[model samples]
Target: MKREIFVVADNIFTPLGKTTAENFENLKQGKSAIKQHHNAALSRQPFYAALFDKKEFPKEDRYTKFEQIVIASITDALQQSGLNTSDEKTVFILSSTKGNIGLLETETHTPELFDRISLSASAKLIAEYFGFKNQPIVVSNACISGVVAIITGMRLLRTGQYENAVIAGADVISEFILSGFESFQALSPGVCKPFDKDRDGLNLGEGAGTIILSSNPKYAGNIKALGGGISNDANHISGPSRTGKELSLAIDQAMKDADLSIGDISFISAHGTATSYNDEMEANAIALSGLESVPLNSLKANYGHTLGAAGLIESIVSVQSLKDHVVLPTMGFEERGVTRSVNVAKSIAASSKPNFLKTASGFGGCNAAIVFGK
Candidate 1:
């Protein structure tokens, strides 16, 4: 039989809060981190996003903002897990679409700093800082990077390659990313409204999130990572699949891997990027998986589209909801948007179910689904 993998500890550093608990509290209170920004470097027009303050993170000349947040998040998670980062059996994984990419524009004075622009370089730097024995693994897959990272760690642990895996993901909002999204007209003029008929586009955000998965059940707090699956639409580089068929396959496979059924999932933590295609695509996928009635909420409404950190942070919140037996509302959602009807959580509600599903789809038509249970 495959080894069991459990999520022992996790933390998130975002504009919402510094710790997982703080972020959850703010979420429960219906607070969102998204706001309008006037930074000329980020955008010529006022853009909506969730950004952490400079003072909120340390200023280290050797570390970029991305590195600082990743280190901070993973350190807290490792501390809470009581796992030694230096342990030989502990592996580190970094997930991000853009790691220290901003260094390209700002570090021109130090041409050598150009090397830091590589994702692998940033991961190695972090691994060295924490004294990790293994070479750090970096996952740069579009938006699904976080979930893919977790799935990667789970598979590694199942092979007995590692006893503990520290998976962390983060992506900072930069002028390059902002301009790219603007070019696609994918940026919302205000806070995104997932699954709402009036929803237009997504708001970009930045944050770091870390989740520690271990083979030891003793470290399992209230949730375990049961099974997950990943698939690509191979339809578009930047657009999602026209039909939700590809993503539906991922959801179905994850359920089968976990020995679960539609009735077993009490809620769904959807990607809910609020873009016309993404929301509709996810709706069709959920319906195809026969989970149309499962109550669902999108963290995007609370955190905006955090890109790399989206999956990890959103999964952490889903675990919190399962533990608390409460379903957080789909913030900013007022009307149905997709063709396939879904039970979008309009208000906070109590639930006794023990299992939840988290699904994410990103650029390049990548889709991932992970099943978790308390």
Candidate 2:
């Protein structure tokens, strides 16, 4: 029999709150952290985002903001799991689209700084802090990094090479990030509205999320990582596939791996970035998978787009939703704007099904899907 992987513990650290429970509570109360900011350091023009107070984290010469959030999230998850990281069977996987990229603003371009900005180096430093015995793995596949990291960890555990996997992802908002999106005109002027008719663009946010997965059955009831699938559209460098068939392929593979039928999935946690193309593409994909009525919601309005941290944070919320037997609404969604029909959640509702699907798409035509269940 294949080894079972369960979510032993998890944590989400964002402007909304520090802990998972706190974040969930804030979501339930319909509170959002996104607001307008006039920070000249990030952008010349005003922008909207969910950002942590600069006072909360003082200038630190040791670790960058990205690393600091990752460490904080992993620490809380480890504490909750009570797992010893010093063991040889425990491994760490770090996910981020941009790690230490902000250092370029202050530091000069030099060969010595190369190693410092490398994602692997950041992963090693974090692993050493927690005393992880094995070499750390790093995933940097655009926005799908977090889900890919989880899937990679699950495969590693199934290979019997590791007993526990500490998966965490984070990215901090910087001038580099904001300007890149701005160049593409992908930033919404105000709050984002996923799957809504008036949805324009995505709002950028910064945060971290950590999930610990173990092969032991002792961690069972919380939820299990049933299966995952990844694919690429090869459509455009920054744009997703126009047809949504690639993402549908990924969703099909995940369901096949999980040994589930369409009816088994209770709902979908979409990667609804509130961007015009992304939300529309996701709707087409769901319809392709015959899941147009699955009742899905995007958490972008609650937390904004956390980039590399989005997949993990959204997955954590999906788990919580399943456990609590409620599906949170897609905030700011009013009318259907996509070409295809979709059951875009408008209000909180009960969910009795044991399984849920999470999907994500990012730059470079990458798409990923994962199924989690009781």
Give the top-scoring candidate (lDDT).
2
Cα-based lDDT for every prediction: 0.91, 0.93
In terms of lDDT, the poorest run of 10 residues in model 1 is: 103-112
RMSD to truth, every model: 1.4, 0.9
**TM-score of each candidate?**
0.97, 0.99
Backbone clashes, each candidate = 0, 0
RMSD of 1: 1.4
Residue-level lDDT tens digits of model 1 in 119-216 = 98899989999999998899989999999999999999989999999999999988889999999999888999999999999999999999999997
| Deviation in Å, model 2, residue 253 alpha carbon | 0.4
lDDT of 2 at 296: 96
| Residue lDDT tens for model 2, 197-290 | 9999999999999999999877766689999999999889888898999999999999998888889888999999999999999999999999
lDDT (Cα, 0-100) at 344 in candidate 1: 95
Candidate 1 at residue 200, lDDT? Answer: 90
